[model samples]
Target chain A: MSSSSAAPTAKPPMRDALVAAAFRLFLDRGYEQTTVDDIVALAGVGRRSFFRYFPSKEDVVFPDHERCLTDMTAFLAGGEDEEHDPVARVCDAARMVLRMYAENPTFSVQRYRLTRRVPGLRAYELSVVWRYERALAEYLRSRFAGQTDGTLRADVIAAAVVAAHNNALRSWLRSDGEGDAGTLVDHALGHVQRAFGRPADAPVRAVPVRALPDEGDERPEDVVVLVSRRDAPVWRVVQEWEAALGRA
Target chain B: MSSSSAAPTAKPPMRDALVAAAFRLFLDRGYEQTTVDDIVALAGVGRRSFFRYFPSKEDVVFPDHERCLTDMTAFLAGGEDEEHDPVARVCDAARMVLRMYAENPTFSVQRYRLTRRVPGLRAYELSVVWRYERALAEYLRSRFAGQTDGTLRADVIAAAVVAAHNNALRSWLRSDGEGDAGTLVDHALGHVQRAFGRPADAPVRAVPVRALPDEGDERPEDVVVLVSRRDAPVWRVVQEWEAALGRA
Candidate 1:
């Protein structure tokens, strides 16, 4: 599908054309080898037009990022309705970002490749990602304004959501072909929720308290034995704990 | 004291000398006007020596960043003893970063100014900051392994700590003159801890529960009140329920 076919487009096709040409040239002749003039020539646009569309050659690689950021901000600011839970609102906000990447997987993949090779572009992308985190944090802060841990909670939640989104997006991009990006994003978000969403003050009334061991015994009060190492079996640790508790 | 009068010095004087020279030159003749040759000449070092010390002119502006990062990594990695308490370890790890910035306020101030003006340097600095967050998050994940919310907790703690550090550092730098930076850093770290250190899944046995009364011939069980704000006063809400129960 041609970009020109879109109806009532405020931006000229030359901008998208330049971006498409830049990606093609970058992939064909390498990012460093491909010049601004080459990109403009390939797109059949003049030198002046290229500059008008983009401040620098690098701008061609990440077209509409600013627009996406604005859209995300608007979406978040509009999520002030009291009907939804804070967690739901956060997930919806994260979805806005996932949808953006999913909408243009081809361009995103090309951009990811170029970013990997170019330190400057990679840094730029990171900065953009940080901005998203900032926006999300701000929204969460506003939503949880009266809480003592509002800012801290907001910051952590924002970071976790962004990290999960990034991890999933990177996995998708790394694969040779795109699959169910939506499902991946959902799964990633679930991972984040499970990781950080444990109720900080959940009722502990039902917790089974084991009695303290006798004095002069090896087992110390206030000490909980936990198995360390990644490959350690979960069942083994649980069994060991249960046996130790029995002895106590 | 001269840089060379070293007694197991933390950082070489030459590095400090180069940074000072670069900052002065950047301020005197804009960032773009300054050159690597000028910095080396001002620092009383040869071009070859400068090259040996720093890879590029930009490196001089952020001389101790790599060391700071290394120190932070070491601090986090050294927390194997407290592996079960990810929150405390992450807080302490973040404090090490604040200490690094406070150790050299003058150089940090100059670096901050340069970063603000030079887009390239800003991007570079951001990448380093992101790396610090990444390291903190990874360490948190390792420490919090097997917890239901381990990854999310790690991500949130890392992000909050970084944000708190940045906020404090920026405030210190923006002031007309420096104050007790250590105290400020402590205050910031405390804020972060209070926010994210609340033990997720910690027993909420301390929470007081209250039942509400029936109203207008409708059973209290039929009427449900939803709290959408995270900051809603739980104690007040409980008190209201207690009063309603008394009425019943």
Candidate 2:
């Protein structure tokens, strides 16, 4: 076969190298103890190269987040097909994010731990999460434009999706890579889908219809009343409903 | 009245004084350039007293989030009668948080600016937010014990409520304290309420009825099929729906 499968030499990208080095140093020396100098030295890269790859030490820990944000923005922007469904498009976008973490499980795990211990990294991670929610909200706003209260609905949906993803990811990380995280994410997203979508029709219920009073009759049953309290007790509200229905 | 009225000599809480001082210093010297010593000195409180009020410098910049979290937890835990309707209770709990911020608009705005510019304060704020979500999710899990896939639903609901609050709060903050934030929060929570709760019996098209096929009746319309594609073109999907309904 003329050695058709000759070995190919490939080198890690500067960004990836820096990220790997940062993760290692963060784990070995603790996030606060580790400095940019130590990371550049460990990665065998120049200070300028390090700076080019990351704006600061914290940036080294999360190199791909900006790229992921951009990719998610693009995906949401490209979602013009209604057949794909807003819910499905959102799920697919979330899957893209999960796949990004899965692609670098070690780095993600380490980053997760570092974020837990380091306040600065945790804030940075939150900003990244906020960006994700913003992108999702923007996409949803377009999809549900005509619906009443569309902006609020979009914000809620985006937040729910991100929370599901975070919850599933946290569980996977806590288990030390023992579970099927992808499946868990799907299950989580399913919860989100059901929350906003309509439920399947329930079994039909047949009940006898009641006669209404004559329009000119001036009795209490002749007039219907509706009362609502936003913060009233549920049972009290139910009682009010029953009373208003003349069944109390 | 013979001068029987008591004098109005009560000042803002020591904590509030420290927060005001810290905020002023943050504005003047930048958040990073300010120190705990300077804040206590400006607030005219001893270092021990400052520690008694706030555990750390970053703590002074935030509202009493810990107190709010505790109140929320207590409110959620006290849901003896309304345990079945967690959605309502969760909304109420979230409103409590919103009200806390609204009560102190000046401090809230200052803290918001500091959080935006200071990474450490921002992380502390995120941690507080995460705690709120966790408390909400726990309450929801308890309420939805018998339901299938309850945990995920609970988590998503918590996330949605938090997101709505944040969205409304951010809008209020960015607008320089203009507008009715309480009304906005109510509108936001209403979106969440409708998402998980049943819709009102507003008039809508009646669902199509499907009759069961009798034996030996091989009508194509009797056996309905549904095919959904993740990335199908919207027009194609709509056309398929129309075809299935015999509209085209």
Which pairs of residues have clashing backbones in candidate 1? A156-B156, A195-B149, A204-B204
Put down candidate 2 lDDT per residue, B1-248, tens digits, no spaces: 11111323222468668878888899999999988899989999989988877788877776467777777888888884642467878888898878777777877777787788877776778778888988999988888787876777788888998888888888888776678889888888877775564333332111223446678868523222223222222223223433444531
What's the TM-score of each model vs. the native? 0.70, 0.72
The candidate that wins on TM-score is 2
Put down candidate 1 lDDT per residue, A39-151, tens digits, no spaces: 88899989999998789887777777666677778877877776545655676677777776677888778788779999768877898888888888898889889986576
- Clashes per prediction? 3, 0
Candidate DockQ values, in order, are 0.12, 0.19
Q: Model 2, stretches more than 4 Å misplaced?
A: A1-11, A80-84, A117-120, A142-147, A197-248, B1-12, B27-34, B80-84, B113-121, B145-147, B173-180, B197-216, B219-248
User: Which segments of candidate 1 are over 4 A away from where they belong?
Assistant: A1-7, A10-12, A77-91, A137-157, A175-179, A186-248, B1-10, B81-84, B144-153, B176-180, B187-248
- lDDT, model 2, position B120: 72
